[model samples]
Target: MKRDYDIIVAGGGLAGLIVASSAAYYSNQSMKILVIDRNAIPQQGKKTVSGWVCGDAVGKNTVDYMADRIKISWGYPEIEHPVKGVIAYSPDHETGISFDGEGYILNRQLLPQRQLRDATKAGIEIKERVALRSLMVEGNSVIGVEGDDLDDKTAFKKTAQLVVDCTGVTSVLRTNLPIKSFIQRRIDRDDLEATGRYIYNFELAHEDKTYFDSDYCIIHLDQKLAPGGYGWVFPKGENKVNIGLGVQQKAFDTRNRVMGVHPDLKTLIDEYVEVNPVIKSPRLADGAGDEGNAWGTWQVSVRRQNDCLVANGYMLVGDSAWMPKPLDAGGIGPAIIAATIAGKDAVEALQAGDTSEKGLWKYNKHFINDYGYKTAGLEVFRRMLQGLTNEQINYGMKHFLSKMDIDKITKGEHPEFSTVDRLGMIIRGAMNKKLAEDLKYCATINKVLVDHYHNFPETPEEFSEWHKTLTGHLEEAFALYK
Candidate 1:
């Protein structure tokens, strides 16, 4: 006997759970959906994510849709100051300001389980401790998922007409499949960072009405002293915090051109905190994960062999889709927003009885059209910013800091960055400095990237043309600095 589901969602994380619950709720009557997760139910209470960048992982829409049974705990007190801007430290202790556009810092783990419970209520079945060992494919189209039941050491296969890979960067299932996607890149020591965070006694100075506060996501450069990327202290409420480091793997990799070696993140941080007393640090034992770092670690950049992210009867969402913002490696917001839309699109595709390769590819189009522009554009921006020194940073900050106009919006309640100001600042900064002049070339290339992703032209021919054009643009852009 063969058991078939309308949809099979693999890896029950934020994106997976969100889409699964959505399918169950909105289009579930005819949809027999199965979710295979390494863990059972929600990770809300038992799970601990110590050093996530976004304090609020769940956006407004996600929270409103979250199930009541799922409990959410903030890393900090419910009320505190909403940090309006950021202060950067130079190698010689030079300081500069960057707007902290109005955003919430949250415990972040609360919304995933909430989404799961809501999804379960919509009729999605959960097979706990089911590790996806491989994929079940018929010729080119994905037919189902294959996995090992870790609890019983038995292999079980669940067949579905359509398979959605919501797995994170590891993308165990998507990787096993034959889909080609542009999202292929390996992290080098510089492209990667040893991210370590701790929770300790803290205080809050920023707060506002309606009980929302802002916390700073601090950054510092000085490769020798600071590592490849910047250091961030994301405030959770006030006392609780999620502080860690994010680096560009290429910085480390190109420097050493080797893998398996990154800055000793935790130990390095331990040393930094000992010298800097303001950063009340958390102990290593408080960290999450079973890795050698022992406290916390997250990888960046992984995709299937090619940019073939979409195929007949399949679509990848979230980290599985390489949906992260390449600039700072931010995936939470894009994941939720993209997955929310993908869930809606998948349901529509299933109902149309056209779950063909082309049918599912609509999700890709919608995702790229929606958030890909911002993410890909930021990647170029991040690369340029990371290459500059303290003097360059100060120049850029002075010229472009106010371009975000964070204070103007949300009535001082939600300080946020404005796109116009940002662009102007970049333009102004590049016009004056020699290095900036060189980086300007990539600016057009990034715009081309922006154009390709933002436009998301329909039809394979059009997509192909734009994609090729974008590639050429990236080469041109990166070539300027190189």
Candidate 2:
């Protein structure tokens, strides 16, 4: 069979560009690859009309992993500001836990330019303003993509040996795929979060590490402020920050009913920015690096990645696969990891002359074992945390979390609950017995989920039974959280 390209990447975003570059690198720049994006050339990978909507913070370790593997590194204006780590504060703002290791708050607008440069330099062709609407399927395989070129109303279609979907959380290609596979076509509303943010350059009203810290990314866990989600103050520079919040719709509605207020995401975000004591006279930083990306909102997935990542000639990467960290709604890290591995696996499958479900299965197993193992556990923990009150969160963070638990969280691993830890919580008295019990339950469930993911099926044939058990575990956890 003849194909227009060896690989057709359905997006030109952060994930798509990186994956294309990786494939080019691993294939010795010999593969015929094409990257298509809905945005124009200047805004090649712009995520939305408002801007490149994202938290734009990623751990240095993940970045290093890609650099080492694909020889593509980011610096200067693209890297933006360096953060020592992430510190997650309790709702009361009285306690803080080091959540993640060293990382950087990226210049979302500028980073795409760097990514585009890398993709082009790698010999990958890019088609801007091309909206990929659906996969072109033949038999059980995805052969290419078809959509409209925004420049005109003309239809566009292209064929490839393999199609990689890196489109955003609401990707039409993934949702409208014309094939039957475990790659979940639709994400549940409950699993999606409405998020918005502002890039602000503010004056320091006071030296308050709790509210603003240039050395560390700050996360505020407050149910009243961000129901079923959290607010973040990620530094972009000494005087600038990317401030935002995310909320689950059902939880947001419940919160509104309880407070007798009808506030939308914009209202809550504006109110959140206004209440910050340390950021005085904050203004949207619309200068050089902030152009067309100073403010925006987007949907994020707060669940584990799709149960199946590949089927026949099709594969899912980044947000299309729901690859964000469930606990914090951070997609960059997982996206990097997934994109890197997907590219390598895709190349190997191509070389072996087999792009079928069975041949491309290694991508699934490799990703799950390497990074996806922890996400399901984090999802379970996030569900439990969303159900807690402000007081419960404060109490739990103060008493329930031990140094070991914090370390586990910092390393992106699920914290295990020992009998001694549960007993210690019990000894803390009946003052907050339910909260302690809930924490213990979540910890236990997390361990179970992590262990299951660690043993993810090595072949597609075993996925049914494996997924059945996973579903059972999640159902049990969901019932308990409810």
CA lDDT, every model vs. true structure? 0.55, 0.89
- For each candidate, give its TM-score against the true structure: 0.77, 0.97
Encode model 1's per-residue lDDT on 336-374: one tens digit a residue.
666677667788888887777677666767666555555
Residue-level lDDT of model 2, residues 385-459, one tens digit each, is 889889888887887777888888888877664543656635554646776677778888887888898888888
Models, CA RMSD each: 6.4, 1.4
Query: RMSD, model 2, all Cα superposed?
Result: 1.4
